[model samples]
Target: MERREFLAALPAAAVGLSLTETAKAQTEAEPFPGFQPPGVDRWERSDVEAGDRPVGASFGTRSEVFGRSGAAGTSHPLATLAGIDILRKGGSAVDAAIAINACLGFLEPTACGIGGDGYAMLWDPKAAKVVGISGSGRSPRSLTLEAVRSRLRNGFIPPYGALPVSVPGTVDMWWTLHGKYGKLKWAELFEPAIAYAEGGVPVPAVVAYYIRRGMTNFARPGMGIEELDNARATFAPGGETPGVGEIFRNPDLARTYRMIAEGGRDAFYEGDIARAIDAYFKRIGGWLSYADLAAHQSKWTQPYSTDYRGVRVHAIGENTQGLATLQMLNILEHFDLKGAGFQSPLSIHLQAEAKRLAYEDRARYYADPDLVDVPADWLVSKAYAAQRAKLIRPDRINDKIRPGDAPSRGDTTYFSVADRDGMMVSMIQSNFRGMGSGLVADGLGFMFQDRGQLFTTVDGHPNIYAPGKRPFQTIIPGFATKGDQPWLSFGVMGGDMQPQGQAQIIINRTDYGLDAQAAGDSPRWHHEGSSQAMGEDDPTLGPRGLLRLETGVPDRTAAALAAMGWKIGESDGGFGRYQCVERRMDGNERVYGASSEMRADGLALAY
Candidate 1:
C-alpha cells in the first residue's frame, strides 16, 4: 500500500484490534521494522558528580531507566513510583495514569489537581488505534463577553481571581476515563493520593520553591489577600511556606478524595463537595454554579495526527492548541532538521519562525470546536505546511508574518505510562498559571484553575468568553505511533513552551536518533512572540522578537541567531519539563525506555 493509503487505514486497523490480540501479534513480528539503534556518539558524561556526594556536587541529576515489563515517567518521583506500583498490581496504563495524577494533585498541587482540567491519549494495543479524551471544562453558564469586558482592567482579564474560575473538570475526566479504560475499581485509584494527603508527604525541592513563590506573590500588596490567607492556611500552616523535606499534609483534600472515592465523580460534581465549591465561588464573586458542574461532561473525541518521517504524531483536537504542535512539526518536516544539526542557528531559526506562524493562526482561529468551525484537517496538511514554511526565511527573522489565507486554526503536569500489557497513555492535567486562581474552596484543600482567563472579550473571536464554551487550552498530551501501533507517549508542560518542546522532542528522537532522556534533556529554545492582550510578559519578551535559549545551547548558535535580527537570551524556567516512555520491540520482546525531565526533581522508573 502507498504511504497515504496506509495512513488512511491506520484508524480502522488500530480500532479493530484487542489488547490480547495486539500483544500476541507484536510478539510474533518485529515491531519497529525500520528502527535505528541509538548511536554511540549520543551518550555523554554527566557534569554532576555521580559517586559519593562531594562539595559543590549537584544533588538532582540522574540517569534514564529501562525496563521490559512496565515503565512510567512523571514530574515527581513519588508519582512515578505510584504508577509503577499500580502497574505491578496488574493495572492498565490508564489505571496507572489515574493513580499518578491523583498523587500529583497532592504532591505537586502547583501544577495539577482535581480542581483543574486534563487531556489524554490512550493507545489500545489490541485495537491498534489511539483514543483522545478532552477533559477540559466549560465557562460558567452566566459568563458572557460583555460581563468579561466590563470587568477587564485594560481589555485583558486578570491572571487570577473569580473572573478566571471555570467549572472544575479534572474529577469528571478522571471518572470518565476510569469508566472506559480502567482495570481497577474507581475508589482504588484514589487510595495513594488520599493516604499521602492525610499522612503528610515531604515537599520536594521543586514543589517547595513553587510554594514559596506562590506565597510571596499572593501576599504582595494589591493582590488577592483573602485568597492568599486561604492558601497560607492550607499550604503554609506555620506562618511560612514549607521547606524542602518538610512534611506537609492536606486533610481537607484528603476528605475531598474520600468523598469522591465513595460517591464517584458525583461526589465532587453534585454532592456536598459540589455544594462547598458552589458556596465558595458565590462568596468570592465567581460565576461557577452547581448547574455548571452538573452539566459538565468529558468528551471522548477521535484523536488527530500528522505524519512526520513515517511516524504519526497524535494530539487532542479542539479546545486545545495541540493541533498547532502538529502544524509546527509539519512545517519543520519540510526541512532537514538533523542535517542542519541540533540547536544550530539554522535549526532554531526555522523552528521559531514556524511556531510563530502557527501561533498566529492559533490566536486568530483556534477554539472550542462546538462553538466555531476550525479547519482542523487543512491546518495540518503538508501542502498547507509547505506553504507556511515558505514564509520562513533562512537569512533573517520574518517580522511581517500574518495568518495564512488557506486556513486559520489551531501547562501543567504531563506524564506517560506504558504497562506490560502493551497499553500506553500520555496524559496532561493543569490548573493554568501555576497554583491557578488562588481561590481555595473553603474546605476543599485545592485551588480552582484560572483557565477561563485565556478567553478573549473581542467580539466574534473564536476564543471569546461565552456561556458553556471551553477557552483555548495549553495543557496537551502527545502520542506517536509507528505502523499503527503504540511507539511513543510524552508531554512537555509550560504555557507557550509546550508546542515548541513537542516539536523539538520529536525531531530529537526521530531525526537526531536520541533516546527519550537525551531528547528531553537537550538544550531547548522557547519562541516568545508578542504578548497577547491577556498574556503575561517578561524582560526576555519583546516586539523586536526573542528566542529564549536554555543554558545548554552553544554561544555561537546564540550569536548566529542574534546576527539574524532575533534577540537571544538565556531563560530561567518557561522552557518546559518533559517526560516520555518509548516502546521498542526487539524481535518479539517488548522493551521500554523512560525519561524524566532533568530540570525537575523526578526520576523515570521501570520494572
Candidate 2:
C-alpha cells in the first residue's frame, strides 16, 4: 500500500508511536523485505552503474551549479536552502550567510554553534577588495598560566572540559556582520533556525553519524568532563542520539535564539545567557565567568594575500593559521606545477614539504599579535617563502624542516554566499573538537567552545595559556579576486587540513583547469603528526609524519611516495570538505558557478 493509504488504514492507536517517533526512539525497526522502512532513507554515494558523464563534462560526481543573480553553498542541504530563502527576501550576502550559519548551528551543531568562535573573509563589492573579521573569543579573566597549569594532564590542557572553555564569539560575529552589511532586520536571521529548533528537523545520516560519535566521546569517563548532564539532556534525549530521518527538536536552543534575536549581542555576551553560563561554570569550578563574557569583543583584521597565476588569493591574518596558505602558495608559485602534472608524486612531495615547513613557522610564530611580537610581514613574504622553499627536494621529504624567522599565528563548518549586488561572504565557524567543551550552561542548550585547549602551557611561548588572550584557532575562510571582480568565496573544513585543502582547490581550478565541482571532487592528501601547534616545547615527534592519501590516488603514486622514505597511509575521511562559489563575467553580464563537498551532505544552488 502507498504511505498515505497505509496511514489511513492503520490508526495512531494501533502503534504506541508514529513512524517518525518510532525512528526517533533510536531502535531498529522490524524487518520487512521489499518494504520501505522509516528512518532508513539516507544520502549515499551515487551508484557507478548510473552511467558515466558525456565528453567534456565535469569529472566530478555532479555538474557545477550555475546562477546569474546569486548563489549559496553549505555543508548541509537545509542550511543552503535557508541561505537561498534569505536572499529571495532581499537580503545581502552577509544576511544570507548569517541565516545559513544560524541554521547550521542547529542542523549540524557537532561542527558549529553560537557557543563557538568564527572567522570570515568577505569580498565586499563597495570596497572592491576582500576584508577579514576575527570573531575569536578570549580566555577567562580569572585564568592565569599557573592556574591553567594546575588543570593540565600530561603537560597538555584537556581537550574537552571546563578548563578548555572560552567565551563564545559567534553571536558578536553575527552582530558585527549585520551592523556593517546586513540588509534585512537583525532578528530575521534567526527565524529559520529558531523555527527548526522548536518544530524539530529530521536528522540527516551524516549529522546523525557525527552526533553519535560526539555524544559517545562526551559520555566517556576520565576525559576531564564535568557538568555533562546538561549537554546530554540537550543533545541526546533518553540517553541516545536521534537516528537518521528521526525528527529531533531543541526547544532550549530555540528559546536562546529568540532571546538573542530580541536582546541583540548584549543578550549573549552580558545578559541572562551570560549569567546562566557564568553560574553553571562557577558551580562546576570552571574558568569562564560573567566578566569574561561581558568583556569579549570581536576584531576586524586584515586579510593577507599572495599572487598565484596573477589571481589575488586572500587569507585571514594574525592569530590564525591562514597565512600558511599564502606562504605555501608563494613557495609553489616559483614552481611549474602544470608541467609536473596533477597528483604526481613530485607535486605531492613539494606541497607536503612546504606544508610542514610553513606549519613549523605557524607553530613557533603565529600568535595573537597583541600579545606577541610576531614576524607578521616576513611570514607571508615571497622572499621568506622562497628561502624556505629552497629546503624542499623534488624526490625526498624535508624531514629536517624547522621554523625560520617569523611572527606567528576541527571539525569545522564552512559556507559561502553571493548576492545579486556582487557581494560575496566566506565564513567558517566551529565548536572546537566536536561538540565543543562538552559542558552546557544551566538553561541554555549549546556547548561552549574548547578553543582554550589549543594553547600550550609552556611559558613565554607565543601561544601560551594566558588570561584574556585568544588561543590559536583552526577555522579560516578563503577569498580570491581576478582583476576587479569578486572571484571566489570558499573554505575547506578540517583541523589543520584547511590551508592544505585551500591550496589544492586553488591549484586544481587555476592550474589543472578543473571546473568548480571537479576541483573539490579531486583526490587530496593530508600530512599529520608534525611538530605541534598545541603541543609542549620540544615535542619528540620526528619530522617524517604519515602522509594520508585519499582512495582516488593510484597505487603507483603511493608506492612512489613510500620509495621516497615517506610513510603512506589510507585516508579515514580527513582529507577535507570544500565549498565554493565562483563569479565570472559572461560578456556584459555576471555569471556564477558553485560547488559543494561530495563527501558531505552539502549542496550548491543558484537562482
Candidate 3:
C-alpha cells in the first residue's frame, strides 16, 4: 500500500504506556506487513529510533579568568567547547561566533553553511547597548516574477528556482560583525574552523538525522551526487557523506575560510568565491551575478522590543517575524498563564488562543518594510492584542484563524553566547531548507540558501517577490533585558514554528519561572495548523487537530481539553533544544543550557 493509506490505518490515540506497548509489539511481531511510511514520517534514524533515550554524547570546557571567555549554544558540545577555547585564547563574541558557525557548517551542513544567511543580536557590555545585524540576502536581480511565472507555466519549477535562490550574506555578515566588535584577530578566529574543515569533524546525531530526512530534497537535478561530490572533494575522499559519528571534513571550505581571513570581505565579494558563484548561476540559467554578490552587505538596525511583565523582550526588527513574538507575548500578558499549572488544559488552551491570534497578524502584516509597509506599532500595540484576545472563545481553538491584512515579513540553528565581560550575543543562521537550495557550488563546499522562495508568488502580497528586497524570514534570535539590564540571551530553531517557540520560551522564563533548559525541555504545543507529516508520524492526529501536545502531558489535561472542544493530538516532542545565558542585576551570570532527552540523539551540556 502507499504511505498515505498506511498512515491512515494507524491508531489515533494519545501517547500512553498502552500505545507504546502496541507500537513496540507491532515492530516486533511484524504487524502492518505491507505498510510503508513516507520518508518525512520516518523521523527515526538508527540512533533515534526510540524517544526518551539518551542522545549523542555531551562534552564542554570553560574558564572564568576574565581576560576573555565565551559560552555558545550549538548542537554539538565540541563545537560549543571550541568557541569557549577561542574565548579563553582572548577571542571576542564575534570571534567565537565565527568559529562556532564554521564548525556547525562542518558537522551540521544540512542545517546551515557559509552559503546561507545569518542574523545577529550583539551586546557590547561596555557600550551598554545592542547592535542588530541583518544577514538575510536579497533575491537575484534578474529573476523577475514574470520570468519565474513563465518557467512555472512550462511545468518547470527550476531546481534552486528563481523564486528560492538569493545572494549569500552569511560570510559578509560574519566579517561585518567581527570588524566592528571583535578583540581577537580575524585570522585567529579562522583556526578552529579551518582545522575542522580541513582535518574533519565528527558528525553529530541530529545532524545525521537532517541529512537522511533531507536526502530526497537534496536529490534535485543540479543538486545531485555530482554537486555534493564536487563540493566535498577536499573533505571526503570519494565525496561520501558521513554517517553518525563519522569524520567529515571540508578542506575546500577551509581554503574558502582562509580567503576571508586573509582579505576580509573582499576575498568573497570580489574574488574567487564571487567568480565561482557567478559561474554556477550561469550554468544553471539562474539570474545571480557577480555584481549582486559584490553589492550584498549586512545591515545594522535597531532591534524591536516590548515590555512583557517586567522583562524587556527584544526581537529582530521590521522585515522579520521577530515582532510577532512580541505580539504573542503581548497577548499572553493579559492572561494569568501560570495559575493554570504547567500542563493544564486551561493553560494550553489560553496559550494556543494567543498563538493562533498572533500568527494571524503575522500572516497579514510582517514583511520587508523597505518594500512593503508593516504597521509595526499597531500590530504590537496593547489595544490590538486585547482586541485579538476578544476573538478567542477561551475553551476552543479558533481553527478559522485568518492571516490579518497588515503589511509585511528553516532547518535553522540557533546558539547564544555570553562572555565574562558581560557581552551577550543571541545569534541564528540558516540555509532555509535542509542544506538549503541543495545546490553546492563546485569548490565552495557549501549549499546556497532558498530564502527567495519565502516570498509569495501572489501579486500585491505583503511578502511578494521584488528585486533587492529581502523575502519574509523566520530565523530570529532573541535578546532580552530587564529595566536596561541584560537578562537573557536565547533562541529556538524550527521553521515557521520559531516565533511560537520563542513565545513559549519567554512565557516559560517570565511567567512560569522556568530556567532556559527547563523552558526548552518542557512540553510544547505548536499551533501551526495540522502538519500532514506530523499526522502520519503518530496515529493520534485526527483531521481537525490544531494542537500537538507531548506524551509527557497529564491525561487529565488531554481529556479536559478534548471536552473543551480542542482537536488535541499527542507527540514525542522531538529534539526541542535551547541554550540560554542569563545574568542577574548583581552582575553575576548563570550560564544554563538544556536539550530534550526525548530526542533519541540530543545532548545538553555546560561548563
Candidate 4:
C-alpha cells in the first residue's frame, strides 16, 4: 500500500485496540527513544543529603514508595507512606489520597498549604468510569478588577501580582472528594498533615531551597514574613533558614490542621482561621474578603478523553488546558509518527509543530468556561488537527508562530492511589508558586496560595481578573483506562509547563512505547511562547529548543535535534522530575518512580 493508504488503514485498525494494546504493538515493532544514560543516574538513591541547613539534610533521609497490582500508592514519601498505610487498613483509594494530601500539607508546606487549590481525576473499575473534582478557588468579590488595578497602579503586582490573591479551594475540594468517594472520615485524612505540622516534620532539601528563596521575597513589612517566623517558632527559632538534617516543626500549622480535622472544612472557611485570613488580606492591601471564603466550593465535572493508538488518554476539562494535551494527541494520531522514530530531525520538527499548533489554540481560546466562549469542540477537532499539522515543514523551523488562543495562566504535588477495591485516584495539590502568597494569617501558620495572581485585569481577555472568577491554574490531575480496564493514573507538576509535560509523558508512553520514568527522563521540549508570559525570570531566561535531552539523553540525539534547526540547552537535568505508577497486565503490579538528579534533592521510591 502507498504510505497514505497504509496510514489511512491505521485508524480503522487502531479503532479495534485499546491504547495499551496499540502502544505495546508499536513498541514491539519499533522502540521509542530510550534514555542514553550519561552516567548512572546519580540521584537514584532512596535517601540523600540536601539544603544549606541541617533540616534540609534530614529531609534527604525520607523514602518514597511505588507499588503495583494488588494495591499501590506514591507521593512524597511521608504522604505515600500514609496513603499506603490507609489502603493496607481497608481504606479506598480516595480515602488513602485524602490522608496523603492532608499529610503533605503538614510535611510539604513550602509547596502547599490549607490556603490553596486542588484538582483530581479518578478511575473506578467497578463502574468503568472517570470523574473530575475541581477544588480550585474563586477571587473575592470585594477584589474587583478596579481594586486589582489600583494595586498595579501603586507599583505593586498583587504579591506575585494581584492575579494570585483568589480565595483558596483546596480544603473544600478535599472534603468534597472524601464525602463522595471516601471510606474513611475526613478527620482521618487530617491526622498525617497535622502531626507532621505540629510535631515538626523535618524540612526536606527542596523545602529548604524554597524557604530561603521565599524569605528573600517575603521579608518586606506587611508581606507576612512575621507569620512564617511565628509559625516556625518550633522549627527555626533563631530566624535562620533551617539547615539540612535539622528537625523542622510548625506547631501553628499543626494547630490549624487539627481544627480542620475536628471541625471539617468549616474550620477554615467559617471560623477563626477564616477571620485571621480575612484580616491579613485587609491589612496587606490584598483583595480577598470574608464573603469569598464563605462562597468557596469545589466542583465535580466530566473529564475529556481521546484514544491515542489503543490507550485512552484522559484529562481535566476547560477551566484548565488539560484537554490541550489530548488535542495534541489527536493531531499526532493522524500521522504514522512512530515511523519517524524518536530524536530524528523530522520527528523533532513534527513534535515541535504539534506543540506550537496546540499552544496557538490554547492562547486564543482556553479559559474558565463560565466566563468565556471557548470553542472546545473546534479546538480538538480532527479537521483542526490536520490543519495545524500542515504548519510543520519537514525541513524548517517555525519560530514565528504566535499565541492564537491561550488566555494565560505550583508546589503542586501528584499522587496516584489504587486500593484492592479497584478505586483509583489521580490527585494534585498546590499553593500555586513555591511558598505560595508568602502571607500567612497571623496565627494560621500556613501560607496562602497566590493562585489569584494568575488572572489579568485586561479588558475583554478570557481570563481577565473579576469578582469571584477562578484564575488559570497549574494544578491538574489525569486518569486513563483501556475500555473498562483501569490503565494508568498519573500527573506532572511545573507551572505553565504542566500540560506540556503531560502531553510529553503520554506521547512517550502511548506513541513511543516507553515506560513512565523513561518517558519522563527522555529529552523533552516545550514551546517558547508559553514560557514568555511567566515574567522576567522565565521570558528573558534564554533561547529554548525542541527535545531537551535530560542530562541522560544520548549526545547523538541531542546533536540530531540541534542539527534540525533546534537550539539545544544542556542542563544538570534537575529541573524536571516526575512520579508515576502503572498497573501492568501480568496480574502483578509495579510502581516505578524517578526524580531529576539535576535537582539537588529528589527521590523516587518503589517496593
Error of 3 at 582 (Å): 1.2
Per residue, candidate 1 scores C-alpha lDDT tens digits across 371-421 of 889888888788999888888889898877877675333148989999988
Give the Cα lDDT of each candidate: 0.83, 0.85, 0.69, 0.66
User: Model 1, which residues run further than 4 Å from truth?
Assistant: 1-63, 224-226, 407-411, 531-544
**TM-score of every model versus the real structure:** 0.88, 0.91, 0.82, 0.80
Give model 3's TM-score versus the native structure: 0.82
lDDT of 2 at 531: 67
Q: Residues 283-387, candidate 2: write the lDDT tens digits.
A: 998878989999988898888888899888999976888988998898888788888888888888888888888888888878888787878679888888779
Off by more than 4 A, model 2: 1-51, 55-59, 406-410, 532-541
The model with the greater lDDT, 3 or 4, is 3
lDDT of 4 at 272: 76
Rate residue 85 of model 4 by lDDT.
Answer: 75
Error of model 3, residue 482, in angstroms: 1.3
Tens digits of per-residue lDDT for model 3 on 442-498? 777777887776665555667766777787787888888887867777777766667
In candidate 3, what residue range of length 10 has the lowest lDDT sum?
Answer: 57-66
lDDT of 3: 0.69
Clashing pairs in 1: 14-127, 14-128, 14-129, 17-126, 17-127, 18-126, 19-126
User: CA shift at 276, candidate 1, in angstroms?
Assistant: 0.5
